[model samples]
Target chain A: MNTHRPWKLSVAGWAALLLFAPATVLAHQEIGQITGFASGFLHPISGFDHVLAMVAVGLWGAVLGSPAIWVLPVAFPVTMAFGGLMGLLGVPLPGIEIGIAASAIVLGIMVLAQLRPPLWAAAILVAFFAIFHGYAHGKELPEGASALLYSFGFVVATGLLHLVGILLGEAHRWAVGRQAVRAAGGGVALAGLFFLWQAVAA
Target chain B: MRRAVGTTLVALAAIVVASPAHAHLVETGFGAFYDGIAHFAVSLADMLIVIALALFAGLRGTRAARHAMFALPAAWLVGGALGALWPTASIWPVSTTLSLALTGALVALDAKLSDASVTAFVIVAGALYGFVNGATMTPGGAGGLALLGAVCAIFFVNTILAAEVTVLPVGWPRIAVRVAGSWIAATGMLMLGWLARPTLA
Candidate 1:
C-alpha cells in the first residue's frame, strides 16, 4: 500500500543499474542491415531540395483537394519509378539539378497562391517534377546489405514526407491557418530560390 | 502449481528453440514448421507483394477481397506443390520487384476491379510467388509439411489485411492505405533501379 511515485521508482532503479551494472559491450563487427537501411532512408530526406519539393507536392495536393489530393501522391511515385528506370538505363536528362529546384519554386507558388489547375494538368506537373527527383536518386545503391529492406525504408521515408505536407496543409481549412499555410509556402519558395542559385552557381 | 506452470513454460520454450530435424526447412533458428512461416514472413519481397495484392483486392470491395482470400492461398499451395516436386533455382529479386511494383501500382491507383479480375490477379501472383518460395524453401516431396505452413502464412496475412481494408470507410483511412500502396510501389521501383546501378571502376 505504501508507494513512492512511479517516476521516482524508475529513476532510482535506473540509477542503481547504471552505478552497479558492468560496462556495456560494443560490437566489433559491422552491422550491415542497419547501415543499409540508414543510407537508403536518408537519401531522399537528406538533401534540401529533395525534402522541400516532396513536401511541396503533398502541400499542393492538399490545397487542390479531392482527387488531386490523392492523385498527385499516386502519380509521383509511379512516374518517379519510370524516371528511375531511365536513369538506370543510362538515359541522360540535362539540368537535373535545375529541374529539382524549379519543382520547389513552382509547387510552392501553387501553394502560396492557392492556384487550382485542372487535375490532369496538376498531376502531369507533379509527375514531371518527380522524374528529376527520381533520376537524381536513381543511381544510388544500398551499401550491399539488405538492399530490398533499404528500399522499403527509403520509400516509406519519402511517403512520410508527403504525409507531413498533407497534415500541414490541413491548416488551409480555417482562415488564420490558411495564412499560415501561405507563409510556409513563401518559406519553401525562398528556400527553393536558394537551392536554384546553388545549382546554377555550381 | 507455480512450479508446474514454470516447468511447462520452460518445456515449450525448449521446444520452440529446438534444432529442426528436416533438411528441407530453412534454418531460421525457429524449428521446422516455423521455418516455412519464417520463409514467408521474413522475405520483404514475398510478404509485401502479398500485402499489396491483398490491399488492392480489399480496395476493390468485399466481393473482390472475398475472392482474393481463397484464390491467393489456394493458388499458392498448388504452385508450391509443383515447385517442391520440380525444384529449380529461384532467381527472384528482379522479377519479384517488378511484380511488386505492378501490384502496388494497382492499389495506389485505387483501381475498380471486378471479382473475376481480382481472382485472376491474385491467382497469378500467388502461384508465381508460391512456386519460387516453394522451390527455395522446400527442396522436394519430403517438405510437404513445411509447404503447408507457408500456405497457412499466406492465407493468414491475406485474410487479415484484406478484411481490414474491406471494412475501412471511404475517406482518410482509405487514403492512408492508398499511400501505403504508393510506398510499396516506390520501394519496388527503387530496388529495380538498384539492379542497374553503375558498377564502380
Candidate 2:
C-alpha cells in the first residue's frame, strides 16, 4: 500500500485533469449566447454607448462636487432598476427611444453648463431619466444567463468609469488640468449633440 | 461663464448631430425563451455598470461623494419598483423639458453654493430621481431596463468627460458649458422639428 501511494497520487492527478477537461471543452461549444463570467464581463464593455455613459456619470458627479456629485450618480442607477422592472412587466411606454436620446442630450448639457442643482431637484431629475434607462436594460436580458453575475460585471465597470471621471474632475483643482477637463466635457458634449441629431433624424 | 456657455452649446450641437443615429436597440419577433435571456443579460449588465461607476468613484478617495454614488443604484431600485407597479405612458413634454432645464440651472448654481449645500441637495435630488424612475417603467417585456441603462451610461460618461476635459484654448471652459447648453436646446429643437416633419411634409 505504501509503495503504491506515489503512483496512486499520480493516477489521481490524471483522473482529476481528465475529469475537468471535457467541461472546458463544453464551455466553448456554446457561442453567441453569453453563458459565463467572460460574457458578463464583455457585454458592458462591448458597447461604446455603455462605456461612455457609465464614465459620464462619474465625471458629472465629480464636477458637481459634494452633494450633487453624490446625488446625481446615485439617482441614475437606482432609478434605472425601476425602469427595468417596468420593462419586464410588459408595460408599454411610448417614445421611450426618444426619451433615452433626450436624456443624453439634456444631461450632457447640464454637465457642460455645470448646473448646480439643489440635492432634491437633482435627484428628481435623474430619477426621471433612470426609469427610461432601466427600462432599456430590462428589455434586453438574454435567456438562461445568470442575472446576478451579469449585473455584477456591468456594475463594476460602471463604478470604474465613475472613478475615472472623479479622478479627471479632481485634476481640475490644478490650473491647467481644470481647463483641460472642461474642454474634454465640451468635446464630449459635441459628440452627444451629434448623437442627438442622429437620434432625432431617425 | 463663457466656458460654461460654450460647453452647453457644444453638447447641444452633438445631440443635434447624433440624434438620428441614437436609435434604441430593440429585439423583434424572438421567442419568449430567447428574449428572456437577452433581457436578463442586458439588465444585469446595465445595473452592474451603474453600481460599478459608483464604486469606482468611492474608491478614488472621493469617499465624501459616496452617498450620491450609492444613492444612484438605490434610486433605480426604488424607481424600478414604482415603474413595475404603476406603468403608464404620457407625453409629459413640459415635465421632461422642465427637468432638463432645471438640471442645467442647478449645475450652474453649484458654482455659487457652499459645498455643504451641494451635498444636501444631491441627496434629496437623488431620491426624487429614484421616485420618478420607479413610477415610469412598463410592465413586461418592453426592454425598458436595457434602454434606460444604455441611455444613462451614454449621457453619464459623455457629460463627465466633457466636464473634465478641455478641447479648446485656456479660456474656453465656461464658454464650452454654455455651448453645450445651446446644443442641447438645439437638439430639443431638432427633435421638435422631426416631430413636425410629418405635418410639414
Q: Highest lDDT among the candidates is held by which one?
A: 1
lDDT by residue (A1-202, candidate 1, tens digit) is 5353554555545544444333433222235666767777888888988898988888888899897887887788767767776776667899999999999999999999999999999999999999998888775544466667777777777777887888899888999989998888888898989889999999
**Decoy 2 TM-score against native:** 0.42
Colliding pairs, model 1: none
**Each model's fraction of native contacts:** 0.44, 0.02
lDDT of 2 by residue, B1-201 (tens): 444455455545554444222112232434433443343345432332333232223222233244444444455455545554665744343343333333333332223444344345444434344434444434454444543553355335423433343233334344334323322222222222223323443
Candidate 2 clash figure, as a count: 181
CA shift of B92, model 2, Å: 38
lDDT of 1 by residue, B137-186 (tens): 66533377777887889899999999999999989899888888988888
* Residue A179 lDDT, candidate 2, scale 0-100: 71
Off by over 4 Å in 1: A1-31, B1-30, B139-142, B198-201
Candidate with maximal TM-score: 1
TM-score of each: 0.82, 0.42
What is model 1's DockQ versus the real complex?
0.25
